[model samples]
Target: MKIWGYLSALTVAILFGVWFSLDKTLLGYLHPIVLASATYLIASCFLFIINFSPLKKKILKIINSKSKVEDFITKKEYGILFLTAIFGSVIAPAIYLNGLNRITAVNAALLANVEILFIILIGVFFLKEHVKRKDIVGFVFLLIGAIFLSTNNLQNIHFDASLFGSILVIVSCFFWSMDTSLSKFLSHKSNIIYITALKCAIGGLILLLISISLGLSFSLPLDKLPLLLFIGLVCLSISLPLIYFAIRIIGSTRTGSIFALSSLFGAITAFLVLGEPLTVTQLSFGVLMIIGVYILYMGDNDQNV
Candidate 1:
C-alpha cells in the first residue's frame, strides 16, 4: 500500500475514535435515530454536491465509461447498495449509539472492534479469502482483549448492559463487513463516489422516516450546534469518505485490521474525556491486542512476499 493510503486509513481510524467519544456526548442530548438521520442527511448532501461538481464529474468519467456506468449500475446493484446503507449507516450507528448510552464509551468502543473479527471470518469463509494460522492466533488475542475491556465491573458482569444495544452493534458490524466486501467488488465496475452517495442518501431517507415515525425530537440548543456540526462534518462526512478511499487503496482486510486501532484510540480518549477508569487488565490486554495485530499484519506481509 502507498504511504499516503496507510496514513489516510490511520487518520480515518483516529477520527472514528473521536467520533465515537463525541457521539456519546451527542446521544445525551438527542435520540440515536434522530442523530443518525441528521448525520446521514448531511453526508448525503455533501456527497451529492461533490458528485455533481465539474471536477468530480471529470474524475468520474475517467474512472468509469458512460456505458459502463449504465450497464454496471442495475437494479440489482442499487438493491445491494441500499441494503449496505441500511446496515452500515442506519442500523450500525443506531445500535452503537444505543449501546453507548447504556455503557461507558470505552467499553462500547472496544466491543465495536468485534467487527474486525466478523469481517475476517466473513472474508475467509464466505468470500474465500486466504487466512493464515497467525491470523487466527491474532484473532484470539483480539477476543481476549475484548473480554478484558468488556468486563467493566469484574466482580459483577452486567448482562443488562444493553444486550439489545450490543446485538444491534454486532448486526451492524455484520452488515458493514458485508458492505465493505461488496464495495470492493463494485469498485471495479463503478465510481466509488456514486456508490457511496447512493448508500448515504437511501440510508438517510430510511432513517429519517423512522425517526419521524418514532417521534424523535430534532431540536438542538445553540451551544450544542458547533459539536453537532463538527460531528456531522468530521465524523460523518470526512471519516466516511476517507474510509471509502482506504478500502479502495488498501483492500478491506487490511483496512479492517488497521481500523481496529480505532478501539485503542477510543479507549484513550474515553479515559481522558469521560474520566473512565482504566484497569491494569485493560491496559495489558490492549498491549496484547496491538501485538496480535502486528503479528497478523506481518503475516499478511509475508504472504505478499
Candidate 2:
C-alpha cells in the first residue's frame, strides 16, 4: 500500500464516522427508505453536475479517436455496475440504516468492521486472492472485538433485539463486501466519479420507487435539507470515491482493515455529536478494535493486497 492508500483509508474512516452518526440522527426525522433515497438522490445530482461535462468530453474524445466506447466500459462492466448499485447503494443502505435505527450508532459502526471479514472471504474464494497467517490473526482480533461489542462484554448473552440488530448489520456488511470487491474491479474500467455517480443515481431511483410503493412519507423538514446535502456531497460523493480509490490501490481487504478505524471515529463522533453515552464497554471494545486494526496494518506487506 502506498501513502495515498493509507490516506484514502483514513479519510474514509473519518468521513463515514461522522456520516454514520448523522445517519442515526436523520433516521429520527425520516424513514430509512426515504432518507436513503433522498440522500442518494442528492448525491446523484451532485455527481451529475460535477462530472457530466468532463464525462461527456471524455466520451466524445473516445469516439473521435475511433475507439469503441465498449473498449472503455463494456457490457460486463455495466452488469457489474448494476449489481454494485443494487447491493452497494440500494440494499446495503436500506438494511444498514434499518439496523442503525434499531441499535446505537456506536454498535452499528463497530459491527461494520465485519465488512473486512466478508471482503476477505469473497476475495479469497471468488477473487482468488491469497491470505496470509498474519491476516488471519488480525481477523481473529477484529472478530473478538466485534463479539465483545455485540455482546456488551459478555453482559448480554441472549438472542435479543440487540442481537438481531447486530445480525442485520452483519448481513448488510456482507452485501457491502460484495459491492466493494466488484467496485474495485470496476475502478479499473471507469472513472470512480462516473461509476459512483451513476450507481447512486440508479439506486436512488429504485429506492424512491420502492418508497412510493410502500407508501412511506417523502416529506422532510426544511431545516434538514442542508444536512442531507452535506451527507450527499461529503459522505456519498467524496468519501465513496476515496474508498474506491483505496480499493484500487490496496485491495478491499487491506482497505477494509484500515477502515475498521471508522468504528472508533464513529463512536467518538456519536458521543460528541449525538450525545450518545460512551460506556466503558463501548470504549474498551473500541480500543480492542483499534488494536485489531493496528495488527492488520502491521501485517500488510509492500504489495497491493
Candidate 3:
C-alpha cells in the first residue's frame, strides 16, 4: 500500500508535468485568469457529476464508502477546503502565470522548489506529522537533484528579468504550499470527489468573479475548447483527485516533495510535446530526481499520523 502511495505520487508528477506544458500552450487562447477559471470550473463540474451520478452508490460500494458527498464533509473541512482553494486554485495560479511570463524557465523551476520546502515545514511543525531519518536524507537528495536540474548544471545562466517576477513566483509558491498543508486535513476523509469538487467550485467561481470585475476578456476561441476541456477535465479533475488520494496514504509533506518533480518532468514533456531541445545535462539530473524519490519512498515511516 505504501508503495502504491509512492506510485500514485509519481503518477501525479507525470500528469502535472503534462499539464504544465498544456497550460503554457493554452495561454495563447485565453487570459491566464480565464484559462484557470475555465479549467477549474470544468474540473468541478466533472467531479460534481461523479458525486451525484446515478452510479454513485455503486461507486461508493467499490471504494467501500458509507457516506455520500452531499453530507460527508463537515463544516471544519469546508473551511479548510475554502482556504486551500483560495491559496492554491485562485491566487497561486494567477501569480504563477504572471510570473512565468517574466522569468526564464530556469529561474522559475529553481524558485518553484520552495513549494515542497514550505510543505515540509508546515507538515512537521504545524501538522505534527513525523518522518524518519531516511526521509531527511532522501529530501536532501531530491533537493540537490532539483537544484541541478533547475540550473541546467550551471551551463547557461540567464537573468533576463528583474527580481520582481522571481518574487512573484516565490510568493505564489508559498500560497501553493499553504494549500498543500491545509489539504492534509482532508486526507483522511472518504469523499475525495467532494473535497476536490467543492474546492474547485469555490476557487473557480472566485476567479471568475475577479475576472469579471477587472473586465478581463473571457473570449475563448472555439478552436481552443478541446484543449480547454482536456486541461480542466483531465488535469485538474484527474490530477487533483490522484493528489488527494496520495496525500491520504503518504502524507502531504512527502507527496508534495515527490510532486515537486513535476517541473523536472515538465522539462522532459516540453521537449516531447513542444519540440524543445532535451539536453543531456537535463536528462542526467532528471534521473537523479527519480533516484531521490525512490530513496524518499524507502522511508515512509509514518502514515501521516
Q: Which candidate wins on lDDT?
A: 2
Candidate 3 global CA lDDT score: 0.72
Residue 271 CA displacement from its true place in model 1, Å:
3.1
Residue-by-residue lDDT tens digits, candidate 1, 238-279: 676566566656677777777778878887888898788766
Candidate 3 residues 1-305, lDDT tens each? 55666787888877777776667677766677877888899999999998998765675454334222234677887888889999999999888777766654434554565577567667778777676677676678657765554444654246535355656776887899898878777876776777788889998999999889988898877887888898788877877877776776677877887876777767666666766676676556556655655665564556553
Worst 10 residues of 1 by lDDT: 62-71
Cα-based lDDT for every prediction: 0.71, 0.79, 0.72
| Candidate 3, run of 10 with poorest lDDT | 62-71
**Residue 231: error of model 1 in Å?**
1.5
The TM-scores of all predictions, comma-separated, are 0.86, 0.89, 0.82
For model 2, state the Cα shift of residue 276 in Å.
Answer: 0.5
17, model 1: CA deviation in Å? 0.8
Q: Could you tell me which residue pairs clash in candidate 3?
A: none
Clashing pairs in 1: none
Worst 10 residues of 2 by lDDT: 62-71
lDDT of model number 2: 0.79
